[model samples]
Target: MKKEKVVLAYSGGLDTSVILTWLKETYGYDVIAVCVNVGQEDDFEEVKKKALATGAVDAYAVDVVEEFITEYIYPTLKAGAVYEDDYLLGTSFARPLIAKKLVEIAEKEGAVAIAHGATGKGNDQVRFEATIKALNPRLKIIAPWRIWSLKSREDCIDYAQKHNIPITVTKNKIYSRDQNIWHISHEGGNLENPWNEHDESIYMMSVAPQDAPDEPTYIEIEFEKGIPVKINGEKYDPVTMLTILNKIAGENGVGTIDIIENRLVGMKSRGIYETPGGTVLFKAHKALEKLTLDRDTLSFKKIVAEKYAQLVYDGLWYTPLREALSKFVDHTQECVTGKVKMKLYKGNCVAVASVSPYSLYNEEFVTFGEDDVYNQKDAEGFINLFALPLTIRAIMNEKKIKEEKEVI
Candidate 1:
């Protein structure tokens, strides 16, 4: 008789490591670990080694940094999708791609089930399971956190210690963090208490704003069809460009946001997110859109952006609505090609200038100085026609008031 195999989404973290051993010990299942790297600062070889060492029958380290950026990150960026007006949707969008990889590997391995370390309370559980269900509904979904006896990170630490597993997380430093090329998020521990201020030591990708250098950092970004193509007149691939931008922006303390956001799980959670490069990109991209996009299109796109953010945050990326919204966003980006100069200083990212060939801002039309593009006398008729409805309403109201007074 052969044991059923389970494909586990492994990060070589304390949770997944303990779960890998636990699944083998408790359930008698042959566990295969899969670590998908999306530009997080981790040694993939070491993660694989740790997974194998922790009793995984086989382990794989999949590098999808380029695909993550081009397919997932860029589409979200072009959509201008920012959750709750601040979150860059870094972890949100990445979860779907990760789950997709897990499903693919599970299919390849002839596995009966797929498992993930996402907790029952967080939004990630929904994200992972949604994508898995959407892609491959037949595979069993095992969420250890929802069923395991270990109640907290401290318990996970104990479990790992007892199993003699190699883990970096300890009781003293137990902040739950998720990192990728786009951003790093810090939650749990002190962050659970909304009144408690986040310590400066928790900063990972960026320096504290107060500790940033006195001088401002200026950079220019060029976009083609609303996708960033070059920086400072030099074109680079997606991964390298974002890596460069992260270095510069992080040094200047450009992106660090602490917010109490409404989780998709129907709870308010506090998190600290560091998205240095993403913040600068969002500001610059929005500036370019302002320069090139028409008034009505831009206004409607704002509404679309909010909905897009909701879909990503709620883990509906693989659904039909998200695809339709992306198509609409792509069409909007057709004219959103331009250059934007940004100023980064102590946590502030400001767009200093923007220019586009498709820009509708014509100096000849709106110049206060003498210009032939407009007739000075044209405003009177336009205003009169625009105000006619308001004037009619006011007249009706006055007539009603007069009638009431006569009745009195």
Candidate 2:
């Protein structure tokens, strides 16, 4: 008799490493480990070796950095989807792509079940499971964190030690981290306490604002239909552009955010995020949009952006609503092509200038200087017409007050 095979979403990290072994031990099932690379710095060969050594039937490392940026990252960037007005939705968007890959591999391997290391309390569990179910509803989902007897990171470490599984996490430095091309997020450990100041040592992609160099760095970014194309007059592909920008922005101490955010699973979690390149891109994109997008369209798109952020945050990427929102976001981006100059200093990414061929801003119409495009006399009729309802309401109220005084 042959054992059933399970596909595991394996990161070469403590939690997933332990889960990979535990799944095999607990169920007597053959585990096939799959690691999807979205530009996180890691040793793929070592990850594969560890996966196989930990009793995985097979191990696969799939690189999808370009697909991740162009397909997942760009759309979210174009939509300007910032969760809770601060979060850039970096980890939020990456999960769906990983889940999609997991399904694809599971189908190819003829695996009956897929497993993940996401804890029951965190948002990633929902994200992974939601995406998997949406993509292939027939596949069985196994979430080890929900079922495992291990209560905390300490217990996982113990299990890894007993099983001889190599892990990087130490009990002293146990901050849970998720890194990708766009950003890196740190949570758990001391981060669980909201009052505790985030330990600067945990930062991987950026320097602390106070420790940044005294001099400011200026850079120009060019965009095509809301997607960043070039930096400082040098055109780069998606991966290279982000890599260069990350280094530039990181050195300047940009894109470090500490926030207590509301989770999709009805709880609040505190995290510190470093999104250096993403911050630069977002700042540049918004500056360009200000020049190009009209008043009404921009205003309405703000509402859509909020909803789009929520959808991604809640792990509903494969749904119809998300697709529809993407279409609308794409339409808005048609005129969002432009160039923006930014000054980066001590954690600030400020847009100094912006220009676009589709810019709605007319210098002659807006300037206070004398111009043929506008007349000061035109304001009287415009203001009166705009305020007509208020004027009538005031008159009616005055008449009613006078009548009341007479009657009294």
- lDDT against the true structure, per candidate, is 0.93, 0.94
Model 1 C-alpha lDDT per residue in residues 104-196, reported as the tens digit of each score: 999998999999999999999999999999999999999999988899989989898898999998788899999999999999888789999
- What TM-score number comes out for model 1? 0.99
Backbone clashes counted, model 1: 0
Alpha carbon lDDT at 210, candidate 2? 92
lDDT tens per residue, model 2, 203-269: 8999999989899999999999999999988999999999999999999999999999999989999
> Distance from true position, residue 105, model 2, in Å?
0.3
Residue 167 in model 1: lDDT:
90
What 10-residue stretch in candidate 2 is worst by lDDT? 366-375
Which 10 successive residues of model 1 have the least lDDT summed? 166-175
CA lDDT of 293 in candidate 2? 90
